[model samples]
Target: MTFTGVVPKRRLGPGGPEVPVFALGSWNTWDRMAPPERRALMGRAVEVGAAFFDVAYYNMGPHAEASRTDLLFGETLRELGLARTDYQLCGKLWLWEYPEAGFAEQMRVSLDRIGAGRGGPESFETVVVGDFMGEIDIAQVVRDVQAEIDRGSFASWGVNNWPAEALQLALDTAAAERLTPPSFAQLKYGLVRRSMAEGEFYGGWCADGTLALQASDSFEGGILVGKLAPARKIGADVGGIRERIVAAYPEVERVATDFGATPAQLGLAFCLANPATANVLFGASRVAQLDDNLGAIGVLERVGPDAIRAATAGLWLDRDVRADGVWAP
Candidate 1:
């Protein structure tokens, strides 16, 4: 529970747990790490108080469904003999196929799948539930999740990749019903993809202190860090700007060198520099990468956030990719 020198802890929302500014995410990347390496990486995380984890369950995604991260994580935890209290967890309640799977059923089944009931964190500290592309009854979403919270399934909830309008409706709906509003908003946030979190709509909520910003996919599947030809599966290219992102790598590197930081450190610092970012979630498959990425904390202190943003302002990479109708599977 004793976190290292990551200054300024932020609370997730009202009644939510305060957490470190960075979190470890395992989407399709967990299995690639061998048992010994995974144990070492997690152990380091614990030692440094960087144990906040994003373990979103993949009930229905092409790339993520194929990735058995929950199974792998549970197996690894048992191997390391880590108790439930060793780390804080943020789970996801997928709305990709809502009603058919509902929040209650999803929580029970997925937590069991993750080995929670038998021997894991019994309930997540928080859960993010969104991705409402089509017709979504926001009231029902809140009601169902409220029920789950009462059942001790999760302490608080948040939105994920949801439109600003939908997120507002959820907040409004929760207020009207005297229920719990979402604590945070998880989005495709990073250097290249800043439209959602920093743009007018979502930014307004963040500015007004309505929702905490939890950034994900900040590395663009390693493309931003020079993994231009990643052989493994990555998250959805919401804007289909993989080439543009890859091309920007040199610029990223140049700016990083100028700042006396590595590209990866600079990227993490950029996300962390934003006052709204409660945490930046990234996937690292190696212990060295884990340690290296933590150097971003120093980058934020040395070069600072505004200078980093100004340095990369010419990139012109802040457009909304989904709204532009440019998507790649």
Candidate 2:
């Protein structure tokens, strides 16, 4: 009931300028539905103050054969009467799908789906391209991105899930080639997941002027939502990764109790607490879920430093040693 005016905004990079704090991510919503449903969700997101949409070409599916999440995302935006300039668009090019092209074709298809053409303001304000498995040809990828920028395809470029060393390599390579460097790094960061933000997994980018967009900040399939109680086996639909998370963080139950808030809200608020995080991305299966998550924005505004520290101290990992054991360190 607090109804905070709106979430704050911050620049994507040192010079890229500002965007809303709580961007609505469309990772799952797009691939699973038709264009009309996607458009309706986007409209509702805009109405509730989430003006940024995070998307990606690979979000379509493993191979081009499985889905078309990205295409549907672009179609939704166009149908909703939302101009390219009206919202901050962030898309990703998964190079693994076509390492031969080195992410160029991925970017083109992404732009085309988003309606960014030769004469228009680039549909995607920023494009993130990188590997999920931690191996990348940073130099080649950087060069490919610069070519796109030169051709007016992208306003800016970024890296996703890349470690700090690789990020620095990309930046250095771009500087050497007189090309643009990445302005953002999208990684998984949240109250429950601190490896990236704390520089344990990937060195922190915020200190060097690169913005951090925290995804899976809700820990995928709503594990942080407190839906699975009393240590039961997680549903198959929740996916193997999420089941492992629930099995790992058995202590999450205690943390949820201490916060006097839902696990979902606490997880999101944790990500927002970090000044380094430019925005937190979350998805919803329905409008009701979206509204519930948006309420966390107000919860975030009211939370103080002490609360954040307490939440951090109370992480479920501390109580459940098996948590880290489940995943590769």
Candidate 3:
């Protein structure tokens, strides 16, 4: 259970830093727990070498709430005496707020919220532009991010849920302007969600070293955990994507049994198996869930390339053609 194994170190992108393959997903989970339990979970995560984490301001919930997630994370680190150098932290701009405040302000707010010097620096190893949903001026954003990089605020930057065309334009502009382009992309990818993996965006990243593809929602928001059957039996409203995922569960279960893993683990392995995927991000509400999912790192090599593909292919046949094409819920 020592994460010191080679599993922890992964090249984030072509010339990006060697970050851990799995960074703890800190959405609302951090603030939901009691302070004592929160400290315990952080200790366990560090023990297992899951020192890397990702959090954002807007994702910390309403401004009126208790301590925001960023502040809570920082407090826990200080309480546990974990130095900023002990972990690598990533902060992202929420999809809705990125455009409103622009790059610099968005990043400044996130860092301020996370408090100071809790993750090796008061800054991020990289910060993500949460989503590209507007008439974006890609060149301008890149310059703003480069300014942060120059000031040593963040080492690199990337996009999330951005369209293929927009990503390309940004890259092309960076090349012409001789600025650093995005080093990675964060998007939804899983057994039941294949839009990012099947489309031109993923294909292009796979073909080049300029950007690495990192998967989020690799379980389709827990539908691939294979527990929906009970929920359905109890008349739970498991419709839409949940319905599709439940329908696909049997296939996933069958494959998982072959490898002695749960459907969730198999799903995670399936994502990590993809050539374009440099990293996979997943949620863990408790310490045990964190242990189970981090265990997917081991499952990666045991499952191998061919078995992982055969197990996951054809499950979500229409995933790439979905109307939005970017699966985020």
Candidate 4:
């Protein structure tokens, strides 16, 4: 995780940009910090090479509501006099309302808010198109994303929580058209979840070096860290295994103690252990929490990926998120 202080960096894939293994999410950030604390978060992130951020508009998906997290993030960057190069942003587009919302409209909305604070980049470094709804036109989605990339909106793009077939079709379409393919796939991967990313579909692509894996929801929206009944909205229970996930937390705690680490560290380390994971996406509202999450890097080093995987194998929640074809397909 570190030679000294810097977090490690790896390519998103062969064609994508290199980024740090720890990317922060923008879910609960709007209320967490005052001005100085936010400034300190940015500074410490840069200091530890965790400047990559996943800031998405919550205009769609479960518990959909308006959020100004991205605006505040951009404003903080401007306040600190940080250049665009000082940090990386992974913008997101939603498939929850595809074709109608489209990629262009969403990008326009996201950039306007993020840039409204000034001194922020006009575009994201990379983007993740996520939240699979019913089946949609894969060609149109890929084309729209590629068009955005061509327009310098973002350098590379990835699919989030998409069906394996959709990922395949997107790649095939990109290859056939000679357009840029999605360089990565962000999936729900961690100690409690393994099927999507580690299953045959994505693992093969990662093994062939065709796509990188961005691990998300590894903490199950802080539930893995003993926030058993968090007041804030966590991601929808895509697996329909909330009870199982909650029950497994005890094992997580036990395993983390055995490994001489916090439950948060063990959960994160489990995600990092996977060879395909380009980075682990997490949310840390406070700088102290961010620093605490960083300890997973050390835990990974101490425990080794294999031992960690084996120890937590019983906690794995393997479910095809796209099975029902109602919410996702």
TM-score of structure candidate 2:
0.80
What are the TM-scores, per candidate, against the unseen true structure?
0.93, 0.80, 0.86, 0.93
- Which residue pairs come into collision in candidate 1? none
lDDT of 1 by residue, 79-151 (tens): 7888777888888888778888788888877677678766766788899886666778878989999999999
lDDT of each: 0.79, 0.61, 0.70, 0.82
Stretches off by above 4 angstroms in model 1 are 1-8, 61-66, 320-329
lDDT of 2 by residue, 167-194 (tens): 7788899889887888776665665555
Model 4 misplacement above 4 A: 1-4, 61-63, 319-329
Assess the local accuracy of residue 130 in candidate 1 as a C-alpha lDDT between 0 and 100: 63
The whole-model C-alpha lDDT of candidate 2 against the native structure comes to 0.61
Highest-lDDT candidate = 4
Residue 257 lDDT, candidate 3, scale 0-100: 85
lDDT of 3 by residue, 172-251 (tens): 88889988888888767678767655566666675576678777867655667855543221211212456666788778
Q: Ten residues in a row with the worst lDDT in model 1?
A: 320-329
Candidates 2 and 4, the one with greater lDDT: 4
* TM value for model 1: 0.93
Sorted on lDDT, best first, the list reads 4, 1, 3, 2
